[model samples]
Each structure stands twice: as structure tokens, then as C-alpha cells.
Target: MTKFNKTLLAAAVALASTQTFAAGFQLNSQSATGLGRAMAGDAIIADNASVLARNPAAMALFDEKALSIGATYADVNVEVTDAQFLGQDLGSIDNAAEGKFIPNAYYINPVNEQFAFGFAAFSNFGTGADLTPLTEVEGTISPVDLLGNTEVATINLNASMSYRINDALSLGLGIDLIQGSGKLSRGSLVEVEADGWAVGGIVGLAYEINENHRLGLSYRISPEMQASGDIMYLGTEFEDINIPLADIAQLAGYHQLTEKFAIHYTAQWSQWSSFDSITLENPSSPEQILKDYHWKDSWFLSLGATYDINDRWTVRAGIASDKGVVDEQSSLSIPDSDRIWYSAGFSYNFSEKSSIDFGYTLVVGEKVHVEEKNAILLPIDAYTESGANYFSIQYNYTF
Candidate 1:
């Protein structure tokens, strides 16, 4: 590749970094009940089959077959303002991010007193944004290589099993099949489309201190995804691309202080430091680095409370703090920042074996200043703000 072409390709790839709803590119829309509680103690809360999406060991708490189905609609808003290239105005963009609906399903069955099985379908990562109009500013030279449309999505299908050693402890293991797809383009200079699959796993432990208190710990191993499609590096094309994903670890606790009141909390960590870079590979040539992230690890902390109002009504509320993963290296494409979450929800029981849940959450992000170099090495500066509203509904049945 020529020097100019190489520079252009590197700039475009770097700016095409994933922009998502949660910290890094992770997704947290797996269950409506979990969302209502900001995911606090989700790994140990076995109130419904949705627990299968977090820690399968919780399935041991079930004595009957249970099923849960839910979906979350996320309305994302991102504003990019004060965009300039070497003092020349490049205008601003409003609502660059797109809204999406995330769906999930789970099933759990208890076999005998010591064994259980469960299955779940959900998503852990996704992103969508379009900033291409920033490149169409009339008067000045635009940062065409740094602004574009980028979308990424992934789905996880899991099969899990749990074994109860005794009344106090349970162990669980799960295998995951992940399907992912990505699309990115910058005007007429760059375009990439790819889809592929990967495999990963999770292990969990659930400890019950008593009938009213419990603790859970889990770790998820993620794979370095490789996809094949039309990946253009300048004028050259590559057969495949490799993108590294991060592992996750979480610890949660639940306490029932009163007959009708309960409290829960969670501490979760993401190993984003391991997501160092993206690489392009071809059979005829050596592997090449497509982009470097150099991101840091991140944490999410949540606290929640649940109360039973009546025989048929239950209410819950939660709060959370999410630390951003991006450190010194930041880009206009990502617009990453620290965030806070406020959530509330309710459950209405129709009968002893059936119920419905409704949840809502508001995610607020801090505004941040971003600076990056365009294709011609001209520095571009902008201020970005991102936020979202999540509405969720779920149906749960037990037999």
C-alpha cells in the first residue's frame, strides 16, 4: 500500500471503533427483572427463569419448570458539537446513534434434588451510529476518514447445567455460541462488512448462607472473534479479520432483612485492557494491525431494593455507577464516558404460576471532549454527549 493509502486506512479503522450503550461495547439488556434491579444480585436471584442468563447455579433453586421471555427497547441519543478541523468549522450532528430492540428468552428445569438444566438466548455486545453527515460540511475540508456509519451486533446462545453438592452450595457451567456481524463505511474511501461465529464459556458458584441470604460469583471467558468478508485495506482486500473481546467477572449478594423487603448488590469487572487491537489476516501475506485500542479495565456497581406491596403487586428500584473504559486514548467515534443509571419497575402476579414484569431505566453519560487526526493528519476536535432510555417488558410462567 502507498504511504497515503496506509495512513488513510489506519485513520478510518481507528475512528470506526465501536460505540455502544454500555461501558465499552457491552450490552446489559438481558432481562427485564434484572434491569429493574440494575442487575444487582442477578447471578443469585432465582425468582424466575431469567436467572439462567446470569448464573446457571441459580437454577438449583427451582423445583418446577420455568420459562421467561422479554424484550428491551433502547432509545439512544448522541450529540456531536463544535466539530472543527484546524480551526475550520465542520458543523455538528444530532442524534447520531440509532435505537434498537433487544430480546431474550430463558428456560430452566430442575431434575431430582441435585441436578438442574437451563438454556438462554441473549446479547452481550452491540453498537450502532451514523456520523457520515459530519463529512458533508459545505465550506471546509471535512474529516471524511474519521466520520462514518458503523454498526456491530452479537447474539449468545447458551446451554448450562448445575449440580447441588448439598443445601448450602451449588456449582454451574455453561457453554456459549456467539454470532457476530459488523458493518462500517466512510463516504467513498472505506467499507467493511463481515459476519462470523465464536465459542466461549462461563462458570459460576452459588452459596446460600441461609434461607434469607445468598452470594454468587461468576467468570465468563470470551473468545477472539474472527470473521471473513469483503474487508478492504485501501485498494487491497483481505479474507478475514480478528477482533478481541473482553472477559467478565462478577460478585453479587442478596439479603432478605424482612418478610416483605429485600436488598441486593453487585460488583462487576470487565477486562477491557485485553482488547488491545484489531488485526487483518490473509493467506498470502503477513498479518497486519488494523487498529489499536489500548483501553483500560472497567467496573460497574449497583444496589437495589425490592418490596412486596400486596399479594399481587411487587415494586423495585435501583441505582448504578459505571466507569468508562477509555483512558488517555479516545476517539470521536467512541464518545465514551462515565455513566450513572436510575431504574424502577414492578411485577404484577396474575396467578400463582404466572406473572408479568415492566422495567424502565435512564442512563446518563458525562460530556467529554474528543480529539483525533484525520486522513491528512489534520487535528479534529469535538464535544460529545450520549445517553439512553430503556423500556422493558417480560412474561414469566412456571409449571
Candidate 2:
């Protein structure tokens, strides 16, 4: 390999070393309309094949074949200011990252009244961050221009069984065969390395109350997802960082208020705390150990509604607040914070079995105060990160 490519590869490996080497973090995406409506009741909507990824029980609602394919574009604008290296101006920096296209697909099939199966691919988690021109260049700054990003992806094969317990209740159970991967990169001046694996499974359940109301839940067993890669800085091999992936939980429901309107809500919890820290195995003296992730558990709460405007048009809208897992000790890469969401969407029915769905979301990040001490030219603070914008479209078909 050429020197540039080798350097880039080392850089990539180093980048992956810093990120949680799971499948990459997921995009919190399920459906276009779900995005427009803040993902409320995504587990119970049972509107498309993607429902298999949320709550396996929702598959029971599909008595025929169904498929959903779509993507979301994310526009991220970040601003970092108040630079002070011993109280120097350092000049403020404002820039935006290239927008990302988040895409996913799902398919579901039903047999008789007691069984269903589906497959789905979606971003389970991921985050990206880049900082241009530090206060001081070279020796004065350990990291001159910081550019780092982490990605996680998952493909799940699922099977579900639904039983009609009675005239008023139906129950469902499901299993997920999950595959995941991760990639990392830093400092455009260097190469990027990516490594990760797919591992995770568990159970899911759902319940329907009458013909118009439903609830669903899902859980993934904690998996020791393995991330293996090489990290190189300035042409020197750094070390390898390995992380154990955490578990997930989801609960959601749908309630029809009238023939024309319905309301829904979702509550989800992630065991991020399980990621206490990562241990890097290296041969250097002292082994270059890093400590203190101290990540906390987080939650997401959302409320949304679907309105039938007419025979050909349906509308979705929602708002949500999702807590951050990062604490006061977040890294420079992903200056992550809690977020609030406002979203809206529409679905156009081309026919009873074919339709198009579109969604738009505005995310507002919470303002935060950060301070860096010790060696290196980090900073005493960075700006409150800006929220992101998401636009998505999906083509859905059922047979």
C-alpha cells in the first residue's frame, strides 16, 4: 500500500479505537412517518414491515406480505467558540458536516393466524464529529485538527408467533438474529480503520386491546460485541480498544380515538451504563490506559398523532425528548447532549396496498458547559451544540 493509504488506514484504526466498537450507533430511525411524528408508538403502529425491528408482536397485524424501504438525510451544523488557550482569542469556528443518508429496509410475511416472520436492516447507533483548527498547531496541541466519527449498523432476522387468546386479546412473541459492525476515523490527515461484529438476541412481546388499541415491548440480551482494529497516530501504532455492547428496551402503544384520528406514545430505556469503560491491550509500558466513561442510562419519551385528512391523505406529527448518556466527561469527538424534537410527516396513498411516506424532523441540542484541564490544547469550554435536521421518504407495499 502507498504511504498515504497506510497512514489513512492507521488513522482509521485509531479512530475505531476511540469509538464504542459495536455495530456503530443506530440512527433512532424506523419509518419516515415515524420520524415526522417523533417515533411515538413505533413499536405498536404495525403500519409497515419495519415494525418487526421495533416490536416483533406488531408483525401479527400483517396477515399478508409487506415491505418498506426508505432513507433519511441528516444535516448537522456545529459551532465551537469561546476558545481560550491561556485566554487567547483562538478565533471562533463554525462549519457543517456533510449530510448523511440513513437508509433501511424491512420485509414481513404472515402464515395462517398464528405465525409471522420478517427481516430488517437499520442503523442501531452511530455519531460523528469534527473540529477544525485547534488553538495551537503541532507541538502546542496534541491533536491539531480533530476529526473523529463512529458508526454502528445492524441487520436482524426475526420470527414471531401470535395467538388469539380470546376475542379481545391477541399475544405475540419474537426473536431477533442481529448482526452489527463499526468504523472509526480521525484527522483527515491520516487513514481510517473500521472493525466490528454482529451479535445480540433476546425476546419481544406484544398485546392488543380490542380492535383499535395496542401495546408492544422488546429486549435484546447484552452481547459482548467485539471490535478489533489497529490505531496509528503520526505513523505510530497506538493500541487496540475493545468494548462490550449493551442491552436495549422498548415499550410503545397506539390508541385510536376516532375514525379519523389516533394518538400514541413511546418510552424507551437503554442500558448505556453497562459501558463503564474500555480496556486497550497494548505492549507499550503502562499500556496506555484510559479511564472513566461513567456513562449513565438514558431514556426517550415521545408523543405523536396520526390524522386522516381525507381518503388519499394522512398526516403524522410528534414531539419528543431524549436524554443523553454522556456526562460532564464527554470526549471532543462527539460533543453529545440531550435533545428535543419537533417533527411532522405525510403519507400519500397511491392505492390500498401501495403508498409513499415522508417525514421531517428538527432536533435541538441542549446547551452545555465543558472544561478541559491538564496537558494538551483542548479548552476550558465549547459551544452548545446545534440540533440536526432529518428528512426521510419511504415507499411501502403490501401484498
Candidate 3:
């Protein structure tokens, strides 16, 4: 491949991996109730049908049919500042991240004394950013390989079943149908588009120590996604690409301390170390390594509390720490960093069978210095800061 072609190909790889909204492009906006408490104890809360998104075993806690629908608006803010190449100012980009809305729905039904089933629709990962405007800097050479528009989205449709074994233990299994799509462009130098589907699953266990204490654990198995579309490299087109996704494991606990108060916590892990690289393949040539992430595993920890104000009102608050996944290898397209979450929300009981929930959270990311190589293998330096505000609402009903 020519030097110019190699440069643009590297740029495409960086764009393909860019995900700035959440750590490594993983999303946590499944439900408003979970968001309010930073997802603490979400796997075992069993307060509503939304629990199906986490642990299906929690369905055993309900004796009646339940439904929940909700949506979250993520207002993301990302700024790339003081970008330079060998002392030459390449300018900066303000608000490169885009805003989006995430939606979810869930339903649960108890079939008999020992069986329950549920369905859920939600997103586990997504990202969107536009840095194309930075390529228009005047009186200076633009870093064409480092600036572009990128958008990626994934949705998970789940069907789960739970079996109650005695009164203290429950086991659950779920099947996931994941849909993914992406688009990347760099001012005509390169444009890649793809869409595909994959299958995965999750298993969970719920243990009830007493009427006021419970614990839940779950592990999600992710698939290697294979997508086909227009993938151009050095004027040659490849028919397919394979992207590896990370698995997830989490443990959660809930303790009702008093008649009107409760405490909950969660420890979650993302197996990002398995997401080592991206590969491009075609019938005419051998598989080629498009990019190597060299990312590390990450953890997210959260603690929360709920308080009852009255028969019709309840309030909750939470805090969380999210560790970054980027390791020795970094990219300007991915400004990954450690983050903190502060959240609050409330539920209003309209009656015994219906209610509404509202939650808000502020995510703050640490500013970090990033170093990357340009087309000619020259070092480029930049500073990046990312943050977001999440507002969510949901309607829930029980029958």
C-alpha cells in the first residue's frame, strides 16, 4: 500500500473505535430508576419490570404481571483543545460529542408458583461524534487522518425465563438478539458504512437471605460481530469486518434497613481485555489487522439509598466511580478517562397499580492529555474533556 493509502486506513481504524460518551462505548441508560441510583443494586432491586434488563431471576419476586416503559436523553459534551503537530497549531473542536435519546421497555409475567417469564428491549452500547469541522483550519495543514464523523449504535432484544427453586433461591437464563450499525466519514478521503446482527446470552442467580436482604449476580456473554458493507482500503473494497465485543459481570445487593429506608450497592466489571483488535476480511486476500486496541478491563462501583417520604412519594440518591479502559495505546478519536457520577430521582405512586419515575444524573470525566501518530508517523498532542447530563422518565404499571 502507498503511504497516503496507509495513512487514511489508519484514520479509518481510529474512527471505527471512537466512543466517547461512556467508557469504551458501553451505555448504562436502560431505565430511569437504575439511573437515579447510578444502577446500584439494579440486578436485584425487583421493584419493577425494568429489573429484567439486569437479572431475570428477580422476576420471581413478582406474583403479578408488570410493565415498564422509559426513555433517557443524554446531553453529551466533549471538547478537544490545544491540538498541535510539531508546534504547528491544528486548532480545536468544541462539543464534538452529539446528543441522543435512549429508550427501553420491559414486561414480566408469572406463569405459575415456580415459573416466570419476561421480555426487555434496551441498549448496551452506542456513540456519536463529529470532528469534521476541524479539518477546515486555514493557513495550516489539517490532520485529515485524525478528524471525522463517527456514529455507532447497538440494541439488545431479550427473552428470559426464571425458575424458583424453593423460597430462597432463583435461577434465570436469557437470550439476547443484538443489532449494530455504524457510519464513518472523513471529507471524501474515506467513508465506511456497515450494519449487522449478532446473538448472545446472559445467566443470573438471585438469593434471598431474608425479607429485607437480597443479592444478585449475572454474567453476559457477548458475540464477535461480523458486518458487511462498503469498506474501502487502498482503493480495494473488503466485503466484511469482524469486531469483538466485551462481556460483562456484575454483583448487586440490597438491604432494607428500616420501614422507610433502604441501602443498595453494585460492583460491575467489563472484560475489555478481550477486545484486542479489529479485523478486515475478503475472499481475495488473507485477514488483515485493521487496528489493535490494547485496552484493559474496567470496573464501575456504585452506592445508593432510597427513602420513603409518604405513601405516594419516594426519593433516592446515589454516587458512582467509573474506571477508564484505555491502556498504553490511545487515540484522538477516543478520549477515554475515569469518571464520577452524581444522581437523584423520585417515584410518584398514582395508585397501588401504577406509578411514574423521574431520574437525573451528571457525569463528570477527568481531563487527560492524549498523544497519537499522524499519517507520517509524527506525534500529535491534544487535550480532551468529556461530560454529560442525563434526564430520564418512566411509566410503570402492575396487574
Candidate 4:
């Protein structure tokens, strides 16, 4: 690999590692209905087919055979400003992403009245952004070019089971295997390869209190993704690096104010603090690449309400505050900060066997400033990004 290409790859990892928008390293676009209420108790409620993406314990609620398949379309817009190179106006443009389609599938069956089992698949981590115009910047690389327009994708398969301990109590467990891959391009180098196997587990408990209230608690253990694939620059090898990802934690509850309406909230904590940086370990030369990052831990708090409009239609709306992964050492590669999400969506049951869903969400941008010390040998005086708008839709089926 040429020296320039190697430098770009090193910068790519450093920048890509700090980009964020979802929980831990996962993106939630599984069920359109799930999007309506900001996914409040999606696993515990199990009202629609998307329940499979939440707590496998929710499978217990599915008394009959059920299957849910869904797709979400999202329109994202991002903007960066206050950029300077040696104190010059480098200009700015919208880094917004193209509309993307995210899909999911889940199936559940009752072995008996006491036990239920299910299988599920969905996207966890995804990377998408536009940086074609960044190349024109002088002396400074957009960091976007080093990581390509898109950088990461993760697919998860979960086998779960739920057991009803009593009329008022239930317990659930799930084992998952995750697969991931990414397309990385920097300067004149591009690398594409499959990341390795990762193992994780999920456990949840739900309790029924009286007739007006219900409670739930769930914990999902994250598995570290250890990938082994050739790091290619143009046509040459640039030695591989070991990337370690973070885990997830969620706690939620719900209450019914009326027969036709209900409200719920969720608090999620991700161990993003475990993410410090990425290191490229080379055996031949006993040398390590230069790419260090300082990322802070983040959290999400969501509240949502659901209204049963009719037998075939339900409406839901929610709001969420997602903390930023970028810290004081943030870079041009990830020009973002904390965000506020306002969303609304609905579900229409076409029949007892099938349903379709749609959702729309707007994310209010946060005020985040940029400053990098060891990158590009310069410090950014200030940096910030405007918010984004998103639209989502999905289809759910049961048989």
C-alpha cells in the first residue's frame, strides 16, 4: 500500500469509529409500526408483527402462529458549517443521505400454553452519508472520502423463547448470532470484506398489575465483532485491524389510561464508553497505525402513546432524545452531535393474516462544535450540523 493510501485508511477507522445515530452500534428500522410509537415496548407489547425485533419474551404474547416482514424508507438530511482551512472559507453543502430501504422479518409459534419460540432477523448497524463535494477542500480531507459514502452494515439472527410463569408473570430468553461487513474507500484505496461471528444474549420479564397497568424489564448483552478480512488498497494488502463494538441496555414500562388509548416510556443505556479507539495490529513490521478517538457514552429516553382507532387501524406517536457519540475530539468524518426525534406513524391490518405500516420522523439537530488535535495536524475552531428529516414505511404479516 502506498504511504498516502495507508494514511487515508488510518484516518478512516479513526473517523468511522465515532459516527453515531442509533443505540450502541445498532439501527432500529425493523417494523413500521415499531416506528410509530418510537418503539415503546415493541418487544413487550407484541401488538403487531414487529414485536419479534424487541423482547423475545413478547413471543409469549402471540398465542397463534405469527409472522412479520417489514421495510422502512428514510430520507435523511445533514449539513456542516463553520469550516476553515488556515482560516479560509472552505464553503459547505448538504451531506444528507439518499432515501434508504431497511428491512426485517420475524416468526413466532406457541409450542403450548406455557412456552413459545421465535426467530428474527434485522439490521443493527448501518452507515450512509454523502461526501462527493468534500474532495474540493484544500489541505484537509473530508474524512468522508476515507470511509466512503457508506461504511458499515450489520445483520442479526435471533432464536428466542418465552415462558409464562403464571397468569401475572412471564420470562423470556434469546440467543443471537450477528454478521457484519463494510465498504471502505480512502484516497486511492478501497476494502470490502465480511466481519466474523458474534454471540450475544437477551433476557426479559413482564408482569401484569391489575387491569390498568403493566411493567417490563429487559437486558441485551452485546457481542464483540471480531473480523478477519484482507485490507486492500487499490489491489494491495494493507494489513487487517481488530474492531471492538459496544453493547446495549434497555428498561421500559407502560400504562393504560383508557380502553382505547395508552402511554409508555423507555430509557436505554448503551456502553459506548467501552469504545475508546481502533488499533491496526501488523505482525510483519511490529508497527501500529495512528488513529485515536475520544468518544463519550450516550443514552436515549423515549415516550410514546398509542390509540386504537378501529379493529384494522391504530395510530401512534413518540419523541426521543438520542445522545451524541462524538466528543470534544470529534472530526469532519463525523460532523454531528446529540439529537431530538419527533415521530408519528400508523398500522393498518388488511386482514387477520396481514398488515402494513407507515411512519414519519423529524430529528432536530444539536449544537456541536468540532476540535481535533492529532488529525490533519490542525485544530478546527468550530463545527456544527443542522438536523435531519426521516420517513419510514413497513409491512407486517401473520399466518
Better of 1 and 2 by TM-score: 1
- Candidates arranged by lDDT, highest first: 3, 1, 4, 2
Candidate 4 ranges with C-alpha deviation above 4 Å: 1-13, 16-20, 23-25, 137-148, 189-197, 232-239, 284-290, 374-376, 380-382
- For 1-399, candidate 4 gives per-residue lDDT tens digits of 111211222234454322445533346556777677776656567776566666766666677888777776656556655655456655565553555667778888889988999888887666555444544676664433233454555667888899999878889999977665555555554454434556678888777775567777777776433334656644556465544455666767778899899988877777766666564545675535435556677787889999989989989999988887766766666655777878899888888777777877777766666655434465443455655455566766666
Candidate 4, which ten residues in sequence have the lowest lDDT sum?
1-10
TM-score of 1: 0.95
Residue-level lDDT of model 1, residues 1-399, one tens digit each, is: 211111122233355633555788777778889889888888897889998887878888889999999999989988888988878887888888889998999999898899999999998877778887777877777777777887766678999999999999999999988776667787676687766566789999899999999999889987665666767866678876666667899998999999999999999999988778878789999999866788899999999999999989999989999888888988776668999989899999999999999989899999899887765767888998888999999999999
RMSD in angstroms, candidate 1? 4.1
lDDT score for residue 112 of model 3: 98
Residues 1-399 of candidate 2 have per-residue lDDT tens digits of: 111221222222233322221112335766797897898999878887877667766777788999999988877666666644555544445643446677788888887676677777765554444444543444433343344454433445555555545554445665555444444545543343544344455466668777898888877665543334555544555445545455788889899999999999998888877766544445664544334456677888899999999988999999998887776665544355788889999999999999999999888876655454423545544554556788899999999
* Candidate 3 C-alpha lDDT tens digits along 249-307: 99999999999999999999999887787777888899988667788999999999999
Q: Against the true structure, candidate 1 has what lDDT?
A: 0.82
* Per-prediction tally of clashes: 0, 22, 0, 3
lDDT of each prediction vs. the true structure?
Answer: 0.82, 0.64, 0.83, 0.64
**Candidate 4 at residue 60, lDDT?**
64
